[model samples]
Target chain A: MPEQNFPQGTDRRPFADGDGRGTRSDHQARPQGVTTVRRWSNWSLAALVVGVAGGTAALARTIPSHAASTTTTVVPTAGTTGAAAGTTGAAPASGTTGATTAPGASSAAPSAPKPIAVTSPSGVTTYVMPGTASGTAAGTPAGGVAGTGGTTYVARGDT
Target chain B: MTARTRTSAPALPDAWQDRGDGGPIGVAERPAIGTTARLAAWPAERLHDGAAAVDTVLDALDRQASRFRPDSELSQVQRSSGTVFLVSDGFAEVLDAALRAARWTGGLVDPTVGAALQALGYDRDFAAIDQDAPGAVPQGVPAPGWSVVALGGRLLERPAGVLLDLGATAKGLGADRAAAAAFRAAGGSGGVLVSLGGDLSVVGAPPRGGWPVAVVEDPDRADAPPSQVVRLGEGALATSSARCRTWRRGGRRLHHLVDPRTGDPAEGPWRTATVAARNCLTANAASTAVMVGGADGARWLEETGLPARLVSTDGSVHLFGGWPRSDEAPVDVSAGPSLSLAAASVGCRR
Candidate 1:
């Protein structure tokens, strides 16, 4: 789909009736041949305003489960985990969903839940999250996507 | 929407905490002092999938429900009196749910309160509300009940006199929508949990049992304990709190939990009521009702057959019927593996 460059009040239907100008007059609503940086700035600012007010209020988010030291897999985007207690899923060996626990396994009271180790694909920068677990790495592969990564997987009894 | 930071694909870890046993197993822990989470995952990228679902719904909300954008249908109706802007299913559903809640709450939680809320010091994000700005809440005359904002099979409403404040319900609605999307994306088998701020909903089960969740301290309470843990799965939960807002007037403190009868801060026994329903909106409506209905509200929720956990002003916890239960035995904080993909396969392209 091609984008459009609509300017302010581009529809000239208001002047079509010839209240102030006749239909034959060159009064159609259209922009001049030249464009100014100021116009783009206004458009950008308006978009930013809408984005912040409209998007952030409902956009994606995550936080530690304060009520429970629940294990969060922060499953890498596109990977869906389901009931594969023995990594029995047709997918990867992890076989977990939304970065959570699997079936038929004893729960381990690890200091911090172990984070699986996944090295970033080539050229995909790996960003380490500060102030979080340092084991079994979680999070997006790209560097600086803090919210994308899972907390480091800490072995049981090892904080 | 703050230009969402474009995140690249995430790298998966090499191993998870492993337990040799292989049946559907459930695990939980107290992340904070009070909050608890029980998790059952079959094995799919549930978190990322869930977040993706949230983003898609939020994108639609912007296009359909936004009043901030001048071109939005909401804004159009706001500008014209007695005019009904036929809206899409998504927008209409949100408005319908909001109105239903408004009427059900006896007008205490009205969307039209947007004007009242804006006139108050909360014109911006709660974070931006000035603490020292001195009490100067613009007095707003509460409008008619939601019945005044008509609705049928199609969109019908004169929004000029009534501002639709789906603020409280939007989160709940969004959570359900996102969870549904995630479930669909993941082929609709494994358990799914969608938590937005304080509102959350779940579907299916995790790997083994259900998803455990926690009710954390009021971001305002520095010394608040985190013992509050609720086992949540296959339903939704929400909590409303006024600890985040207060107005000082002649030694009395006013909060945001408003009561329509008096159009003032709610007088109540419980500070927070977390209700679980099939969807987040229902949970939210119940939570808001608790703040307004007070003791009666708690009873009302119990009567409605929805599971509820109400925390009183004194920190006592009341659990309703039908709430999920861990092993009536002591909850094991940890003793199981995160997930294993052996018998049950939870991760398949949805």
Candidate 2:
């Protein structure tokens, strides 16, 4: 029997998406909201401001009554919730007012996403979310494309 | 060799030792699971801790997954072959990785080749195998296919005669795990690189220029100079070749890479395939599958968009998916092995 070939690069996808149990359509359907939020989070502030403007204009035309009273809350973009909040301003139909902010942002700007230490099932590999330093010393800035550091040889074949 | 029956954490082997003096980048090397395990960490101070963490991971993997060890969890599963049995978490995790690789490559790099390998006279470790041994008549016992092995939660079920050899994916997974462990041990601040028999993975922040690696055709040949040196900032790099790990059977030279379809050593156009991926396991899987897929493998690799270097059996080189050009220019992140966009064009050609 021929083997089933999944979409390539599934290795880097989230555990849920890469588990081989879900189809591409299933992924698109299940993560629709989360995907939108993640996409918004990756946008630049300029692009986001333009998006907000366009969204507010659309809302004004669609729901004039709510638009007058609805204040567009510009949640600082950084954390997961911040990204989710960034999209809420455009969603007047949901009854979310500009006064409301992301759950943690109510006190102050949401802090940068903390690096969560994720260990593999076997306890062999651990992936620390990029950006933040938890219990250790201050984290150094991530580097760019690999450049010549020193010569380390990698041979063919599994030794 | 007595099989270690203890399922719990096994003691670190005495062979684990540091190599070379403390330098800008600390390096340690030790014998592990029939291969040499090497670890390099930035900020020399973290070397000791990183080495310790790597040692722990490698040892645990050997105890949990070594097929040659009669006491390993994999051996236990094989002993109870064909029945539904509960597997330890570590064993299950490794098996999951193996199965995933098989699925990704469409069984070209399957784990169910244990019986085929044994029939090819590769039942023992490479070091212990007699290269001169007479070959048995080729049984052409094709692998039962990875689909036969079922793993759910902790319960695994497979037919009685299906044996699994995790050799293809286990080491790559080990490198990933060891690198992660080493990075965590270093307080998750500096960078760590773990190479298990040349399949290497990097984690945490890299140095100013990323990790420099010299890609070689055959690591077994000490005199073999590097073909190319590429700096890897993130993820991992792996090479698979049919030129190494060979034994003579009935005067026929055979390699260890078995083609599941034919139950014979893969005889593809490419003798060696090297790929850079977001992780070591993915890289290893692609490289191995390329060796088995031959010319078609090159096409498959291009579709995946992971930077790959394929050396044909005639010694001609073919670069695909934005692999570093001969000019040695820095890899263009936009065009080079972008893991996010890799799936954009992947499909089954056959």
Candidate 3:
């Protein structure tokens, strides 16, 4: 439903593929246009350009990922691999999972984030797009008090 | 409501002795060049060793519990290879998990599709397999279901030649093991966290606050910074879905998360589901099972009383039982404040 805007140069699909960058038109700005760079001395100028490019590149990089992530909030997750599907570690003695959000959220419905599934045990994952991570699952711990059979989420040292 | 009291210091084996050995949550803490009386606690460098630890468990699983392993205990007892053998105990831990999950999802999370998965596409270890030549996907391969296998405490037998795929359950168990190791090594008196892939659990409060975690939307963006943050203290969380994996064979796209009923990758209303429990094993297993449950899966999760969040295929989030959104400030309140809050929030979830 949200895909109809197409923003600028997006290829029209059934939905906004959830890539999060809004539309594709904003994609090819060559990194430097979003911000301005006064050409400094030759060495300084080149450094400035690269630095500026690098920063923009970083921003540009996060933009789509964030966009895609935001979109993924709505996407089904199980065995799909791409974007967030990247793996953090092999099945481990030292594995770490994705970031943890808190419990008892104040009901705010912003756009959702979609995620890909990654099998850390093998370090190999199949992503939707070739470059994303593949993660297997996301956990949302319900709050308002631990119930029977459900282990209560206690803060460290509270017990 | 029953309250299980705990006050014992966690104990662990030698693998986590180093001062820096707690596990990762999302961007796993990787080891840095150190003057080592202690080792790095990061996730990458530990791959082989970690995999070895996990494989050690799996190998034993096959030897003791699997019906597919030719030389495993279950395998040896079977009258012949033609018979699908199902047995219990060690190997049954994984099977029991799969069976419980299958019942939870109404068979969407069946673990018996190993053979059909291979026949349709994925046959070898993910690392060793070659991609299929792109083409039309053939239809209707019956997924091998857990239903095909029968089991009890130490009893299990399956249909002849039922290849088993423990992909889902294995990860959860591995995460629990890894995190438990870290928690124990951390002395069980301080903050600790462990995460394998996206499955995670926390044992302490992070320096910034409760561990500020992010549930990544796409696996590709895994290394990319997380967008949503979670304030984790002492719990586990896992997300399950199939929004990636675009391998084509038989002229069709085949993804993972195969529906045991259809024997093909799932086509469901929900795309991702994250289940949070006391440990990664429960969270991981439950998340995988919810994928199999579809819409009803969420309701079932609510009743079972696990806190959960489900993202639908059409792009909707179904927050069941009011999962506490971990985006708030990681303020380190006093023990009194924490205890008071804990006491208050407890009855609320019910």
Query: Candidate 1 clash total?
Result: 100
Native-referenced DockQ of model 3: 0.01
TM-score of the candidate numbered 1? 0.54
Expressed as tens digits, the lDDT of each residue in A1-159 for candidate 3 is 143343354332422356675455544342234222323345687888999999999998888988876763321122221223123222111112223222322122111122211222122111111111121111212111111121121222211
Q: What would the per-residue lDDT of candidate 3 be over residues B1-350, giving only the tens digit for each residue?
A: 00121123122222233232123311222210010011112232332233223323322332343333343443344434444333333454555666665655566566676666676667543433455666557565676667777654434556666766665665565455455445444344333455555666554433222444566556565476653444444566677776644467766666666767777676768777776676666666667667765656666676666666677877666655445333322211111101011111111110
Fill in the DockQ of model 1: 0.01
DockQ of 2: 0.01
Ranking by lDDT, best first? 2, 1, 3
What candidate 2 gets wrong by more than 4 Å, as runs, is A1-159, B1-17, B135-137, B327-350
Candidate 2 TM-score versus the reference = 0.64
iRMS of each prediction: 20.2, 19.6, 17.9
Name the TM-score of candidate 3.
0.51
> Stretches of candidate 3 above 4 Å error?
A1-159, B1-89, B203-208, B222-225, B329-350
- Backbone clashes in model 2, listed as residue pairs: A147-B209, B135-B250
Give the alpha-carbon lDDT of every model. 0.45, 0.61, 0.45
DockQ for all models: 0.01, 0.01, 0.01
TM-score of chain B of 3: 0.68
- Lowest-scoring 10 consecutive residues by lDDT in candidate 1 chain B? B28-37
